[model samples]
Target: MATTRKQHSEQSAPGPVAAFARFVGCGGGVGVASSFAVAGLASWIPWALANALVTAVSTLLATELHARFTFGAGRHATWRQHVQSAGSAAAAYAVTCLAMVVLQQLVATPGAVLEQVVYLSASALTGIARFAVLRLVVFARSRTQATAPAPAVRPVRAAAPAGPAELCPAA
Candidate 1:
């Protein structure tokens, strides 16, 4: 059987916090699922490299998903948005890498679960930053003249004539 996606109106769009939560949930699912697949090979390659690879792939998928679902930019996805996504992904990866370093120092042999915990904590922290960048920078509403409202017209009042001198003379 075939399935369909729900249509969302711009005015009725989800709030920023709601959208961010959804985006993270969707993106986190992709990240965790793929990370599990990569975790199996920890012995073969360095844990950090494995985590980095997972982060790259997961981020690519997450950004695409966010563009479609969260920002409502499905067909209108722009190169600028994609670049911002890449930047967010890079930040997430860097944070995870740093966490990996700290984990490595703390334990001689970190298990997959332990590494996953660290990666997730770092990702959660970075997700807030990503949401800010994406909302305020990438998909921000433009203050273009076209969308701006026309200025209101005010009626000009005529100035009072020099009647003060005329009144004094009449008195």
Candidate 2:
């Protein structure tokens, strides 16, 4: 009964498209803010390491946002969700890093503007993918339970007697 009620609540939360919009809004805000931090840190350290640090912090923040606002989980993310989301974030980190590496290979001296453009572009691409994975994988359990039908309740039929109810009549 409790599970059914919980599932019913989750069923009323945002569907995929709405959740995607929320995901982009919340997660993108965090990503953009972290990018600035990453840029600053990169000036002081290696770009890859800076991005990695920012990615970890931003992943935790975004996971909480995704749990509370994006998917309407209405609570803080569990450690499991955080870890799963971190996996997605790691992939996103690899994307942005690879994009930067490619840009460096292509341009002998990319300006700050070019770097930001490439970085944000790669982030946007990966954001879409991250949304899908988060929606269908990380945050999918509630939605799945919500949408799934309740188990059928069939009446228990009484077994018929083997031929002669006359010989074995009920007392």
Candidate 3:
């Protein structure tokens, strides 16, 4: 006897919203790694340029992971889709960075603690915004036949005789 594996359709796979959320989380991880790399390289290069380099590299890695795993295997996202998602993520990053700057200016905190707080806040905010925008726009699907539910199946039964075969047909 041979065993056969069931082929799962993309529609029947996990929810898009959930997959996107996971993708954002993975992106955050990549960003953290990039930050560490930048920190090490900042010693050799200009600080501002090092930060920018890390940001670009991390963003690319995150986007690739999102396209591959979050969207589903073998589904290649278009350039427009990438631009839309990246725009949303960039907006979120900008907002968070601005907020951190304002907070730092207002509080006059120590540099080390302030830096940690700022990055943490920005990562959280960016992750959330990425999830929302991706779910709403990037992966939004049409309500077409692709998503339609399968038709319900009902068992068939024979109809009974009208008068019991006319009382058994005289045997």
Candidate 4:
């Protein structure tokens, strides 16, 4: 199918606040879903392993959404973007893990709701940081290049029939 210019620029480089909002929407949505996935996976495997698996998958999914919607890349994330996003995700994973460990130490028998609160709070904070990195580093070039103004093109003028010499000789 053909894409119209309107469709192409539909996500045309949102401002910082708008982009962050979209970033949270995309990341938060994936985060919530991944939390559930982790919980399910933990039943069969170690919690750390489950979280790692979920993080990897969710990072890719979130990166794609952020590229197309949040950052106005208007396309799929590049391999480099995905790798960089994964790095951010790794940091986020560490933060969430650290938060859970802290929660565990504080409460001998923390409830599921309490654990979720800590986890999601940590996720949310790291998500903000991730948005900055993705915007400034991972997808900066794509945004600038896409929205960059096209270069001007001057019309080529034909030779003026050798100017005065041609005019006099021909005359």
Question: For residues 48-110, what per-residue lDDT tens digits would candidate 1 score against the true structure?
Answer: 677777776776677767766676544444677677778888888888788888999999998
RMSD of every candidate to native, in Å, equals: 7.3, 6.0, 8.2, 6.8
User: lDDT of all the models against the reference?
Assistant: 0.70, 0.88, 0.63, 0.88
Clash counts for all predictions = 0, 0, 0, 0
lDDT of 4: 0.88
lDDT of 4 by residue, 55-149 (tens): 99999999999888898877888899999989999999999999988998999998888878888899989988898899999989888887887
Q: Which is superior by lDDT, 1 or 3?
A: 1
Model 1 worst lDDT run, 10 consecutive residues: 3-12
Model 2, 49-107: lDDT tens per residue? Answer: 99999999999999999987788676678888899999999999999999999999999
Off by over 4 Å in 4: 1-7, 153-171
Winning model by TM-score: 4
TM-score of each: 0.70, 0.81, 0.62, 0.84
* Model 3 CA deviation exceeding 4 Å by range: 1-9, 41-49, 107-109, 141-171
Better of 1 and 2 by lDDT: 2
